[model samples]
Target: MTMEPIGTWHGVTTDELGCVTHLELQDNRLAGEIPPELGSLSSLVRLELTQNWLSGGIPAELGNLKNLFSLSLSINQLTGPIPAKLGGLSRLFTLYLGFNQLTGEIPPELGNLTNLNGLFLAHNDLTGHIPGSIGNLEGLEFLALQGNMLGGEVPPELGRLADLRHLSLANNRLTGRIPSTIGNLEKLLDLELEHNMLGGEIPPELGNLANLRSFSTRGNDFVGCIPAGLRTAALNDLAELGLSYCT
Candidate 1:
């Protein structure tokens, strides 16, 4: 018996009905803005156009892809605000729009993606408070909003993401104390809050994250000693802990 590879071969994938289901063109040196006509592919389930020179705003028409579950447009020259319409893709689980020139506050409408598992909007021009509505994504495992201009207190609602494995809010203008509720993320492996304006004492409750491999709160305004529990126990064994900047 011969073994076969899983999923489509590459250029495109179609279903039994010949409807496009997956498309990938990463690092193809592709240029120009994404064609709004792409939203016409009603049956499309996955789309990738990463690491290209694509520019202009994300098409509002993409919200029409009811079947789409993954969309990656990272590392492009994309500018303007992310379409609030994207929140309408009810089936979406992974959405990557990082490393672009995207501007404006993250649409509160994105909280509609209750099925999301990974949400990456880092390295953009995003500003304003992190939406509390993001807490609705109970299935989310990865959330990255670093390297932006976002400012405000870390919403306590983020603590509701019980499934989060990686959480990064580094290199932003965020301020305020660390919410102790984050200690609830028992599955967390990497937690980065460095290079922000956040200030306060380290929360001892973070010691609950025994599964962490990398944790950092450096380059912030935090004062006092690292929690006694954090200096020893399982956390001390992490591959990287950036508390050296704590005062």
Candidate 2:
């Protein structure tokens, strides 16, 4: 007989003062709405409950975790808009709320998280333009906003993230030309913008992103020859290139 995947929730940790600091319960077979009382864990530093069967709107009370550094609740059946109150997380480093049934536009209040390093909100029902305020995150390294219903032009402000390594805005309803500003992310490693309505020639400035490895603009209205800089194999050791259906 096959053994059941271990579902015991056992990574709880506490500080010397007896305050709960970490609670990890990924794949724990949890169900029902998250408890609002969890917000009372005033000393909590990290809380993760990914890959479970939880549903219902995310409790706004979670925003009360003033000391939280990381929060992961992906791969669940959660719904409703992300809590704008979460913008108050001044010390947050990584925030993962992807692969849920969340709706509504991402709250601009999230821009207040200047200490954020990674932000993942992909594969949801989110709509509206990419928030320009996100450019305020000077230390951000990873940003994934793919597989949503967001529209509008790619914000030029995104180019401001100098430390960003992975940037994906793929499989959305975004329009307009690829911004030249993106080339400024010299640290970018993987960039995907496939299956959108974006047009115009791929910016030649993109060739300047020496660190780009996986690049795709495969399904759009773009016209013009692929830039010569992209044809060179040595300059950008790309592991994957999806230039189909757009050239």
Candidate 3:
């Protein structure tokens, strides 16, 4: 568990020897809820249970793992809201909990993980506004929260995450304008916001993004010119922009 394990999911049969540090149980027939006893493994570092039939909300005991780094529980039948205590894992780097039946707004406690690099919470029935506390994740590079019923404005606090390279908020019921503060994301490479109810000028401030390579507004009600800085930059010069009209 101290040693980092590699390789993709191979189902429940993956070796669980005490000395065997890494294990992946993705895309398998392993049914039933995640075992609470599994949290007793003090050495486990990465646990991926994606693309399975595993049901039930994540066990609160998972917060007991101090050494855990990567935890992916995406594409499953799990229900109920995310465990708020998950924010206690200061060492966590990547957390994926997409494509589930989980409801409720994202826990603000997640902002406590300053070391997190990737965070995914898409395709669920989640409601309420995105938490502004997420702006505290300075190390966050990838953020995905598409295909949900999430509403409310994108938090301007998120603009503080200079390390963010990818941002996706597509297919939600979100309203309000894209924040001008988004101009702060100088390293962002991709920004996706399709099928939402976003309006107001596409903040020209977004043009400040020097690395922006992809931007889309397929079904939103955005009105205004593309940011001049982005339009003139070489990054957008070769980029394929996506836009559509829905009257």
Candidate 4:
């Protein structure tokens, strides 16, 4: 049965031959929990269910889709912990679960996704330390865990992500000194760690970030003079430097 172009509730649709590979139900005002039967679609590669009113925990059955490469469930009212079963999607390259009401610690199993290039979990009610295993995503270029209740020191293992360009951990309960190893992100452009409990002097090693364009550490418990390199022409090229509320 071919899907009608008009509108439908559950947003269920299928190809003319009844074979499904890609399912897009985004912005259709979809409600209710996603059907766990969707896991039976072994060939499904992309699932877009964003911008809807869907509520309930993501089904663990989704982990059965071994060929699935992209899964986007952002901008919805989804709650509950992200299923650790999702880590079984070995081919997944992009995972967007941001802008939801998801709580609990991010599953460390996600670190097993070595092929993931983008992982967004921001704007949620998630709490717990940022997983150090996240550093295992060697291919990841964008990592956003901001706007949550996560607390603890910034993991130095994150320095292992040499390909990372944008890293935001702002507006959380994070504390402890900024890891000096952050200088390892040579490709980093935007780095935000603002509005947290982070203290101690800003690391001088951050001056080594020659490509950094915007850096913020404001609204924290940081003390001591700003790194001298931050005042140099090298870092002056930054578009923004937030140091307000620091001593």
Model 3 lDDT tens row, 1-247? 5343432224222234533234477887768999987777667678878898999889988887777898999989999989898999999999999989999889999999999999999889899999999999999999999988999999999999999999999999889999999899999988888889988777768869878878766677766567667753333322333322221
Model 1 / residue 95 / CA error / Å? 0.5
List model 2 lDDT by residue over 23-101, tens digit each. 9989999999999999999999999999999999989999999999999999999999999999999999999999999
- List, residue by residue over 1-247, the lDDT tens digit for candidate 1: 3343323555578888777888888998989989999999998999999999999999999999999999999999999998999999989999999999999999989999999999999999999999999998999999999999999999999999999999999999999999998888999888888899988777877768778777776677776556544543334423243444223
Question: Per-residue lDDT for 101 in model 1?
Answer: 94
Error of 1 at 21 (Å): 1.1
Instruction: Assess candidate 4 and give its lDDT.
Output: 0.86
**Tens digit of per-residue lDDT, candidate 4, span 52-139:** 9999999999999998899999999999999999998999999999999999999999999999999999999999999999999999
Q: Name the 10 consecutive residues with the lowest summed lDDT in model 1.
A: 237-246
Q: In candidate 1, which residue pairs clash?
A: none
TM-score per candidate: 0.89, 0.89, 0.85, 0.87
Q: When superposed on Cα atoms, how far off is each prediction in RMSD?
A: 5.4, 5.5, 5.8, 4.2
Off by over 4 Å in 4: 1-18, 231-247
lDDT of each: 0.87, 0.87, 0.82, 0.86
Give the C-alpha lDDT of model 2.
0.87
lDDT of 3 at 34: 95
Give me the displacement of residue 239 in model 2, in angstroms: 14
